[model samples]
Target: MPEVVVITGGSRGIGRATALRFARRKGIRLALVARDETALAAAADACRARGAEVLTVSADLAAPDGPERAADAVVARFGRIDVWVASASVFSYGSVLDTPDEIVDRVIQTNLTGHMRAARAVLPHFHARGGGTLVFVGSLFSQIPGPYVAPYVAAKHGLLGFTRALRQEMLGHRGIHVRIVLPASIDTPIYERAANVTGRTPFPLPPVVSADRVARAVVRAARGGRAEVAVGAAQLVTRPLRFLAPRVFDRFIWTLQRTLGLRHRPAADTTGAVLAPMHDPGAVSGGWSRVPLRHPRSRRR
Candidate 1:
């Protein structure tokens, strides 16, 4: 029997890349869940081309029953789920006070609550099977919060707490594993799809890692059952800095956000993909590599 994996946010970004990565492994079946039907179908087709059996579920994970329904459908199709990847997330760009209540709630629901729901739906199956892996695709923000992304930062922090607690609960269950992969800013459509309240366009801090890097880490976690893995050189340094000098690190992050995180070019304030599925399905990369990296001082001049 093949290993069956169900991945949320599988339509694009890290989820899509992870699906493709798993496709390379022989005898792996995949069920992809996301809101965009077109994108989900495209992802499933791509996986199938790589010779992996694929199922696409177009469901808004923020919906109360969405995660459970996806889990049920996957089990029905594949007989069992060996691994579950929680990677679906929506981005928000604004101060907590500036961002609308709806956007904040949506971000929290999609990024944090959705994962909880997925876990709830899968835990019973894992208990019955006597073994399974759960991988949460978190961010470096899970440790150190950044400015102008209050909702995202909060969600990541909550996710980390959730992962830790769940891991502790499964301590004696040798067959069950809970893992988390925290990646630094990856070149993904999240920046484009983020709800932007700032007058300027939102951009990730420099040295953006590729989605493939994060995807590979997630795959490794699933196979190795590592408790937690943080990807990227920046993440390595940031974690230590955060621990060594809390206030200084906070100031540094604030400076970096004001300088490198936003561009002066005016962009119309829109909810991006937080509220609705994007009309055009996104790919893994946001093409940030092509954009020249500008220094903060250079932007001012």
Candidate 2:
């Protein structure tokens, strides 16, 4: 039987790249899940073009039953799931007080709770099958925080903890694997789809990499490479800065936020994709300059 993979948020960014990566291989089946039907179709078409069997599930991970429904939909079609890459997430750009309660809640729901829900939805199948992999695409923000985007950072921090705890619990199921890929900001539609209440435009912290970079890491982890994989060199640099010089870390982060993270021009406040999905089916890249250059967005009306 072919390897059956369920990828949440597979229509865009790291998830999209990961899907295509897997599609290039032989005997791979992909289930692409996201809120946009158009986007899912677009992604599935791309994967199919690459020679992988594709199923697109249009579902929102933030909804209470969303993850379960998506999993059920995939299982109904594929019969079994070999790997679950929980990569569906949304971004919000604003200070804690500036961001509305709903937006904050939605970000946590999508980024953190969604991953947890995905695990709940799929682990039973893993136990039944006697082996499977769960790969959560996390962020460097999960380890080191910056100003603005508080909800994303907090949720990712929670995701890191969730991964650790889940890994410990999976000890009984020797064939069950839990992994996290913590990449420094990679180019993705997330910034473009983020809800931005802050006047300044949101951009990724510098040293931006392609979504393919993270996709590669996701692929490796899914194939039982490592429990925790950090994608960018900056992901390595940030940790020591946080631990060795806490005060310097704070100043450095603030400076980066002020200069690079936020663009010079002011942006309109819109709840980009928090309340809903973007109109575009989306793509593998955010249209940002690749690594060795960089930047990082909002809610829509």
Candidate lDDT scores, in order, read: 0.89, 0.89
Candidate 2 lands at a TM-score of 0.96
lDDT of 2 by residue, 189-237 (tens): 8887899988987777767889998998899999887799998878677
lDDT string for model 1 (188-288, tens) is: 88887899998887788877889999999999999985699998778877889999998999999888887778877777889999999985666888876
Candidate 2 achieves a global lDDT of 0.89
Cα lDDT of candidate 1 equals 0.89
At residue 218, give the lDDT of candidate 2.
Answer: 95
RMSD of each: 2.8, 2.8
Work out the TM-score per prediction: 0.95, 0.96
Candidate 2, residue 3: the lDDT equals 93
- The residue ranges of model 2 lying beyond 4 angstroms of the native Cα positions read 290-301
The ten-residue window of minimal lDDT in model 1 covers 292-301
Going through the candidates in the order shown, the clash numbers are 0, 15
* Model 1 residue 69 CA deviation in Å: 0.7
